[model samples]
Target: MSDSPLFQPFDHPKLKTRNRIVMAPMTRKFSPGGVPGANVADYYRRRGEGGVGLILSEGVGIRRNGSRPDKAVPNFFGDDALAGWQAVVDAVKPTGACFAPQFWHVGARPDDTTRNLPDAPIDSPSGMPWPGKTVAEPMTEAAIADTIAAYAEAAANAKALGCNAVEIHGAHGYLIDQFLWDATNQRDDGWNGPTLKERARFAAEVVKAMRAATGPDFAILMRISQDKSPDGSIRLANTPAELEQLVTTLADAGVDMLHCSGARFSRREFEGSDLSFAGWVKKLSGLATIAVGTVGLDVPAKSKLFDSFGPGELDEVERRLDAGEFDLVAVGRALLADPDWANKVRDGRIDELIGFDAKYMTKLH
Candidate 1:
């Protein structure tokens, strides 16, 4: 392996990744009937066998009616789903890469109303995707309690099925993110008070519950992003101080690490501060966090601005990693394009690494 910090081993109480490179969770609707089968297992096994350090599975729905909006997206709970995931764990374990499933719920998504649960009511913190628009009634206390329990139970199942870690999908305008964003969560209750800490309470409760359900060895990761999808205007915290408060509350509640997401990983998170989102998180929480955006690539994933079909490079990523800007690096489309990304880099075969291509994304590589 090259003498880069990104190639070093990671040994923590909660996880022991083979290296500091992580495969970010990217959704693939390959599973049918919400069940991931042999193909899914083989898909992940290929990545593990290809030399990824850790593999974070795509957003998997819990055992709730509204958990998954797409029938093709995998579920984390239920007999068939768990069986499929257990097989996946078995398949990937031999490659020495740890795996985690990201729990997800698309609360109040206007488009997903009829996808997973046609008749089941759509519910969010304030019954809207944003302010001044009502998608459904505000979630009842019982509904909120059930959602939290579902998350905890899912974590327990993941632990039992030999998953090395678990991630709560509290990002990208999903259910948990709905609770974090002020525009979506306008509740006056404990879940939504006037401050960022208050807004984090519900998500904290879910993490605390997951912590109680799983052992210390079971690494728990929480993914949070300032901007939601499409809209891009939503932000959980406006300033560094606000971000500190928000992440601290969740960390204190029991999150082992944070997966900070942005369009550009190393870009400045705020004015007059050069710290990236993950940098601020690592500094504020004193916990390991994943820095994700674009690595080894010039354009963001799913971007329409494909002028030259970028042959992405990694000099900037290596510089930031060597500088200790973030604890770990999460590569998304780059890894998807070339499964042996980490291996090639470790072997000093930089020329072998490929760039972002739309064709590679056609399948869930």
Candidate 2:
């Protein structure tokens, strides 16, 4: 127990940490045409220069047209995308920070209006994600195989482009999250079934494919959460026991580090337990963990994106970090509001911390 969250180091054999703070993967939506450019490079470089130990690139689509909308988030597929990501990597490397990109697929969450292209197909675990609306049908066996291959290809490309690692976006009600959630996943095929292990089958296969592609040294991180974004649906092993099982299975499947996401960092995942969701998963899986939420801000980071406000408290975070419940901490909106946030906190200039506003989220270079 260090008695402070602001400054602490996490030492895990798989995850090399320069400091205790991880620049959480916050979607900047700045990439133009799914390609990261100089502006995106500068954005990340600034953060790294300011002392962000590890930088998780925004949710990069595994394939073109796989995202929720025509946003600026970069794509990992294609030669152009690879070159663009290389630029980002080149920019961040000078700061001597570890970097990884979050590989993602939006699944049924994409709207026809948001996709920009009307013909882009949105796939799901089942033909229907919710009632009365059909975006696209469930993935056929061929489609599933193609997706797995795409992940492997993208991972290889990432390694080629000099990315230190890759994170499979297995959370937040995205493609993988859709399959993990029982409500969205109602298929009876080999990929989907009632058993938890079966639900984890697809993700496991993708991980294995990526592992073979990236080799042994490059780290592979996994991001998971109990709640999904957009509607904030509870999914992916909601209970603590089930969460333990889920994390254990993923760890066994080859995740080097587990980034447990949540809306609030301090709250315990299970009732009657002092351990938070990250705490529980770290304890259960015995892996390096990064805890992320509304840390050190006046408002909950995503309130405007949805429709709500979240409680604010830094003392609670400090208390938890002192207890050694989690290895690393992720700052989303706080870092977005101020790129030098980590430096400020470390210099004991907490009074200079800025609150994030919704206006900043839409601005992309």
Kindly report which residue stretches of model 2 are placed more than 4 angstroms away from their true locations once superposed. Answer: 1-6, 233-235, 299-303, 306-312
Model 1, C-alpha of 217: deviation from truth (Å): 3.4
TM-score for each candidate, following the candidate numbering: 0.94, 0.92
Which candidate has the highest TM-score of all? Answer: 1
Whole-structure CA lDDT of model 1: 0.84
Question: What is the per-residue lDDT of model 2 for residues 204-270, given as tens digits with 9 covering 90 to 100?
Answer: 8888889988887778988988887666656567676777767777878787888888877876778
Look at candidate 1 and give me any clashing residue pairs: none
Residues 258-298 of candidate 1 have per-residue lDDT tens digits of: 99987777778889988899989989988888998777675
Clashing pairs in 2: none
Q: Each candidate's lDDT (Cα)?
A: 0.84, 0.77
- Among these predictions, the greatest lDDT belongs to 1
Model 2 compared with the native: what TM-score? 0.92
Residue 332 displacement in candidate 1 (angstroms): 0.8
> In every candidate, how many clashes are there?
0, 0
